[model samples]
Structures are given as C-alpha cells and as structure tokens.
Target: MELIRAIQLLKLNAVSTAWVDAVWDCEFTDAEPLDSTVEDEIKEDVKVFKKVYKQLLGFSKEDSTQSVWNVFGENCVSVKSLVAVLACFVLGAKAKSSSVEQRRHSLQAAAVYLLLLRIPGSVANKVFHQILFDSCLDIVLKCWPQSAGKKRKKETLKSSQGDGKSGKRPKPPKKVSEEMVIDEEDDEEEEEEVYFSAQDLLGMREDVCSLIQTLLKLLENFSLRDKPQSADSCVRLFTELTNLEPLVGELSFSEKRDVDKLQSLPELAYHGLWLLCSSSNHGEGNECRRRVFFTDCCTLFLMMRKERAKPCLLPPSQAVCNARDQAILFISQIVDEQTEATLPLLKILIQHICHQIVEKSEYRASGAQAVGRLVTKMPCQNYADFVKWLFNYSLNTRVAFRMFALDVAMVLLAQEEREADATLEPDLASYLSHRFLVRSVVYGRRSDVSPTVRAHAMHCLAQCLELPSHNATKWIHELFSSSSTAGSQTMMETGHSEQTLKRGETAQKTALTFRTIELTKHKSLAVTTRRSTDELPLAAA
Candidate 1:
C-alpha cells in the first residue's frame, strides 16, 4: 500500500506540473506572433502534458483510498488536488487564448475528469463531488456564448452611429448622462470578457456537445444525486442547457456536423430528466425533495417546448421527435398515477403551469390542457381547495391569465357534472352548490375588459349553470337585467352622451348591486361560499 500510494502521488504531481507548463507555454506563445521555434516548443510541452495525463488516467483507475486520505485527511493539506486540476482545465477552456485547439484540449481534459469522478468510490466526500459538478457545469454554461447575435448587432449599430457623428461636435454635460454612460461601459466590459474569437466559435458547437454527453454519462453515478446540493445543481444545469439555442443564426451556418451535434441535445436533455424522475422515486418519503424534482421536471418540459417553438433552419431529427413524445408521455403517466404521495407533485405542476399561463407563453394552450387534465385527476378531498385557489387566480389583473383561469374553471365544472352522482362527496357537492361561485363567473362575463376574456367567462358561466346541482340561472338573469337597467339609467341621467358613461363602468356598478341583492336575498348563498371570501376584495377592486 505504501509503495502504490507513493507511485500515485508522484504521478499526480507530474500531471499537475505538466499542465501548468503547458498552460504557461500557450499563454506566452499566444502573446507574440507564433514563430516556428515558439510553436515547436509549445507543441513539445503539449505532448508532455498529454503523456502525463494518460498515465494519470490509467494508474488512477483503482481506488487510492490511502493516498487520498494522506493528501486530504486531517493534519494534511485540505485542498482537493484532483478537483483543483479539474478546475484548471475548466478555466483553460474559457481562457482568452485565440487557439481553438488549445480550448478543445482543455474541454477534452475536463471531460476526462468527469469520467474519473464517475469511477465508483473514487470520490467519497460529497463536498468534493459538489465541487466537481460545479466545475463541469461552469464549463458548459460559460462556453455557450448566449445571445451573441444580438450583442454583435447592437455593437454594429453603435459603430455606425459613432461613424455618422464623427464630424459633429457631441455635447454631453449632464451628470446623470455621465453616470449612465459609466454604467453602460462597465456592463459592456463585463460582456466583452466572455466574448470568444471567430476561431473558437467555429468549433464550440462540437466541443459543447461532447462535454454535455460526457456529463450525462457521469450523471449515472449515485454520488452526484446522494446529496441534495449536488443533485439540485445537476438539475439546474440540465434545465439551463435545455433553454440554450441549438443554432444561433450568426454563430453557425447550419452545417451537417453542427446539425448532428445539435440533434443530440433534446434527446440528452430528455434522458437527464428521466434519470432525475427515476431517482426521485427512491426518496418517496422526502416530500420536499420530490416537490422540487417535479417542479424541475415541469420546467424542463416547458423549456423543451420553448426550444421547439424556435424556428430552426434544419429540420428536427428523429431523436428530437422521439424525445419530445417520450417526455410528454412521461408527464402524462405522472398525472395519471394520482395517489396520496403524488398529490404534492401535482400541485407543483399546477403552480408551474399557472406561471406559464401568466407569462402568456406560446405553449400555454397545451399547458392549459395539462392543467385541465391534472385537475380532473385530483383527489375529491383536494378538489375544493384547488377550485378555491383557481377562483382567486382568475381574479388576476392580466387578461390572458384570467381567461386561462376561466378555461380551467370550465373544465372543473364539466368534470363535476360528469362525476356527480348519489354518492357525491360532501366537499365537492358544497363547492358546486355555491351560488356566489357561479355568480362570480357571471360577473367576469359582464365586467371583464377584453372580449376574449368575457367570452371565456361566458362559457365558464354556461358550464356552471349546466351543473345539475347549481341553480344559478335566476341569479345570472337578475344580474344581467340589473346591469342593463343600470346602463340605461346612467345614459338617461347623463342625457344620452357617450362620454358620460364608459363601456364597463355601468357593468361594474351593476355587479356590485347584484352582489348586495344576492347576499341580502339569500343568506344561504353566503354560507355556502366557504373559502371563496378571499377573492371578494380582489373582485371588488
């Protein structure tokens, strides 16, 4: 054991020294124009680096428990030597060197570190594993060059404006303008630090794809998921990668190689999501963890949808289609398998779907259908709580979200109508029998600003009135009649001037009046309106 440990430690030191010499040679050679002599020296150093790296790879395959303890144990150095080397490679990949080959080599080395980390019992400490995960993720994220096209376009515009004003005397005297300019320059400097050369950009697509593929393979290791922090980072990395643009217009010309590399992204992302979901099953008792897992899953689905919505120059590969279908099928299965354990997962899904609706994403229609499907599968005992929440959500100021809420409410009412029987649960029966709830739908139809919202509210009201247990027709009729009477009364009072009464004002006043009358006329309606009182203030506002 002593002999083997000494051999491993010597090999570790050699690898570190070789890597530093290689980086030093590249940095100095890049500073001056590359001459034959300098280029030969740099190549020689790179060869030495590769030779030692290979030896490290081969000899370090076995568990070096005693050696690792000697270096990282108490009364010794606390720094993680292996992880430090990995960080160096990551930094090398993002270095300011103009050599594409150098960056590629660094990326390849970092990927090797990932594989080494995958070796069973190679890294026992969870904290070191977390550090390795962060390094891998950092390389993946920092190399992508997001929004490059927009930045270049903005720069071009600035250059043109500057050239056009070259002959003019520019006057700038305001302190506020000077401060703004200083802030803008600071932002531009920050952005410029990450800007890659044209050479680097040419091969970045293949390099990034290779790194991600290796990382995905590494994810199979149990240590990455054993700790919550590392697991969360892994999840976040996958989510962000999914959101990346597969093909930037200015970056690549959509070559066959680029297309092939980009093709694997969606599929790999799907695999990552599947692994995460399956792993969450092992922790069934950990509700908070499972909730986070489900939330990330839903977010991943949304991001994939957003990616699909982007107009691509090349046709989507079969893998992309297969991955998307499989993801959808997986989400559907989760929704179908409703149980006490999965109820929290379903709630998380609902919350994310609601966020999609609020953002008015192009994928929101499908999300709305998902919401309806999820609500239908909810347990009877939780249905009332969900409905109450949905009612409050519909009162949001955003027209699109309000319309979405109305659509969901229609689905719920339809489900209740379909499921209502002699053995109906008391909570759901009480929910359906609430006249104020039905009248709120009526209020939306009459008072909402957007015609689409009003139309949806009308449909929701129709669904509500269609319920067998709901006797809201008389109330809706009185509400509409009162609204019309108020409108006419206002017009008459104001001498029939169009300016005297705006479009929705009379309807709002009439809604208030009808609410008062209904409350006064039927105290039972108010009693049945359990848990919905929270929305009244919002509605009034």
Candidate 2:
C-alpha cells in the first residue's frame, strides 16, 4: 500500500512532475539504511517539510528537491524512484514466498517498474530489458487462470450377451469404456473455458513494446547528449541491449517493411542497430567510442537497407541514404573533416551496407546498381574477406535476395574484394566458419536457390558445428533452430528444424573429430545425472 500510494502521489502531481521526480529521487536516496536516531528524526523532519512545502510559501524556494526529499525520504530509501522500485523487483526475482500479500506487492512493483521504463530518461534506463522481461515472465505465470476437473456422470452399460444360467447380468462392458471417451471430450471443453481477467492482461504487450521503444530511443538520446549521463546508467542500458540479442524473435521485424510505410516511421525502422552505432561523451575512458559509433551506424544502415520477411515490406533505401548522409555528418563531427583515414571496422561495417543491397537485400532494382555504390566508397584497405563472406552468405543462398539483377554480377566481380591473403593475420577459415555458420542458421535453408548454394550453405553449417560453442556453432544452431521469419523469407518453424537436424549431423561429425555423428540424425538431448542447463537468456532490445 505504501508503494501504491507513493506512486499514485507522484502520478497525480502532473504539472510539477519533474520536481516531484527529483524530490522522489532524493527521498529514494535518503531512504537507504541510516542511523536509528536519524531515521526517526528524519520522519518528523519529513512531516514538517511536507507541511511547510504545501501549506506555506507554495514552493517559493527554487531548491524544492531538499524539502521534497525531506518529506518522501522519511519513508523511502533510494533517491532514484525507478532504481528503488527495481531493487524490490530483484527481491521478487530471487524469492519464492507463497504469501498472497507478497505476490500482490511484487506484481505492483513490476507494474511500477514498467511505467518508469516507458517514461524515458529515467536513470534506471540500463535495466529496461531485464526488468521488462523479468516482470513479463512473472505476470504471465500469475495470469494463468485456475481450472477444476469435471465430475463424471455415472453410467451403466447393459449386458449384450445375457445368457447366464443364474440370471446374473453379464459383466458390464468394462465400466462403460466406449461411453467414457465421450465424457473425456466434454471435460476438456470445460477446462479450456477458464479465462484470465482481461483487465489484468490489458496492454501487457503494449507495455512491453513501449519499453523496447525507449531502449531504442536511448541510442539517439545518448548520442546527442552533451555527455554520458551516468556510467552506471550507460552500463545498465547498453548491457541490457547486449543481453537482448537472444530474444530476437520477440523483437523481430513485423514483416511491415513497406518502403513508404517504413519511410513514414523513419527512426523506428532503424531500431535494432541504432544504439550501438552512436557515441556518448566520445572522449570517455572507453577508447572504442568513435569506432563503435561508426561501426554500429554502419551495421544499422545495412540492416535497414535489407528486405524483411514480406515482399516489398521493409524501410525505403532512401532512409538508408538519409542515414548515410547523417553518418557522414556524424563522421565529420567526430573526426576532423581533413582526416580521410578510416578505421578498418568502420570500413567493413560500411561496405556491408552496399553488400546487403547488391548481394543480400530482397527488394529488387533494375540493375546491380547498389554494387557499384558499395565499392566506389571503399577505403584503400583490402575488404576481400568481407566480400567473400557476403557472397557466400548473401549471394550463395536463396535466403538472401539481391536488390539488383544478377546480370550485373560481372560489374560486381570487377569491383575489388578485400584480399584473403596477409590481411589482419587472422585465420580466414575460422572467420568464414563463423560467418557462414551464422548465415546458415540466421537465414534458414532456402529451397529456391541452386544446389551449389545449398552445398555452400551446408558447408557453413558444417563450419559452425566445428568451432567451439564459444565460437560460431552454438549460435548458429540457435539461429537455424529459431521460429523467426525475419531470419529468412519466412518462419523456419518452431518444432524440430530439419535444417538443424540434417546440417547439425554434418557439422558435428566434421567437428569434434573423435566421432562421426551425422548432423541429420540428431535427437533430443540425452538426459544425464548432471542437471541440464536451460538455454542462455538472450538480449533483444
């Protein structure tokens, strides 16, 4: 009730919400475990402060935070309301108490946590994904309605063969075995009638979406802000973003990538890659700031440019063009306009955009014009490895679609690829293995492409199977095994994936070397004495 009342009070003071937020923040901070003498004394002081703040002066003092905190601090512990609420949720996450009261309080805390996430710029921004998901799982579990078994009707079967000498009826037909089947069906229907309260489930998905939007929005906000607001906040938000990579399905493309429609939404289309692309307080302790910003921007540009699941349903290439201009602008801002030198990561990320359009994007163009665009802007650095990976992943499979005609393949061939030799000194085979493995699983197997491409796809799947789980194979298996259509032209399905089964057999045998287990004959994991670990949590925000 205290939690509910405090939240309500803050919500009701609509006009002065910022001041309220600031005050609540202070109270939250002061509410931390303090001296016994100070704790009791603070309550009285808080009472006096609230009385003076409301009844007299009407908040004449510019410094309202001190008095406001003095009032709320008497009861609360953290200065940041959002963080204070999250701490409670962490309790809920760890505990297993069955008390109804605790359940209700935990649910309320979860609700409050969501509201703060929707209201952007809150300091609790980092854990938005974590809180949202944790709260969602809890809510869903509680929201499942209870049901009861139906009472069976008493029935007797008449004897068909009643020639008994004693005139006793023949044994009843096995307790109405045939008739009992009918009763079971009726029971199932009744059980399914149980329903969760709509008022409780209302806007659940919307609430979830709003939090995701805020997380995506922070990319832009942090990029534009004068400085990284708080290191703790930055760590939390981006860490949440990183953690969200696995829940990609829940955060998938809606197959609504219609160009005009996407153009209308603008920034909304570039939601995924936007965060990692931009920088905050560029000269901070983290040295990768400028490079990360550019690399992420480049990745975002390519993803947006690519086609989504449904045909003609993706953001306009013009949006990519706009972002490109923005990228150029950002580049000029971060690095001196005079410096033509580009980092290797940025160049790779940049060239991939063109790679996606010419070789990978589903949308069609009159010619392979996009290929020309990709190479024209290439830096002096060798990008042959990136080109080869793009060709193998995007062009070699039907899962990848070219935005332009294959007739222009000759021109693309003429364009320079980063040479596989002597560049960066990393094993090309290993990198190729990872790239192909992800491509195979992420896109699923395409039935429309040629056998050669399928063979190449199989090769990549084999590669993932070979690498350590710390490497490509584990992630590839997950991708190929996903039900998301954004991974390919359509949903790859949810149950056992044939792509995984067949390819996995091939991959496993080729890798591990001790045994030759075929990838196609895979089965459910064998149970062992050791408790099996559940799937790792993925970040998707």
Best-matching candidate per TM-score = 1
Could you estimate the TM-score for every candidate? 0.54, 0.29
* Global Cα lDDT for candidate 1: 0.47
Cα error, candidate 1, residue 329 (Å): 4.6
lDDT by residue (1-541, candidate 2, tens digit) is 3342443333222223353355345543332332344324423332222222133222223343434334445655333543443333323422332233333333444444443443333344343444333433334234322233223223213235455886886765554323123212222232223333565334333333333343343343333233322322332233223222222122223223332222112233233233333343322322233323423332233322111111112233564444444434333333332134334333433333333343333333312343444434443333434444333333322222321213223233334333344435464444334343244332344332355334544554565465444445445555655563465433344312344334544334323321111112221111110111211111100
lDDT string, candidate 1, 1-541, tens digits? 3323422432334344444345344532222222344334434444333343454344333454434334345433323444444445455555442245556656655665665564554566432445545656666655565555446856866665544346975444334322112112223343334556787676675666766665665555444434555555555566555445442221211112222244445445545655555444323343323423343443433433122122111123443433333444445554454365556556655654563443343344445656766666665555655665565455554566667766665555444333345555665665543443554444544456566776766666666666654445544555457666775354334432222123366436534432432223222211322311212232432
The 10 consecutive residues of candidate 2 with the worst lDDT sum are 523-532
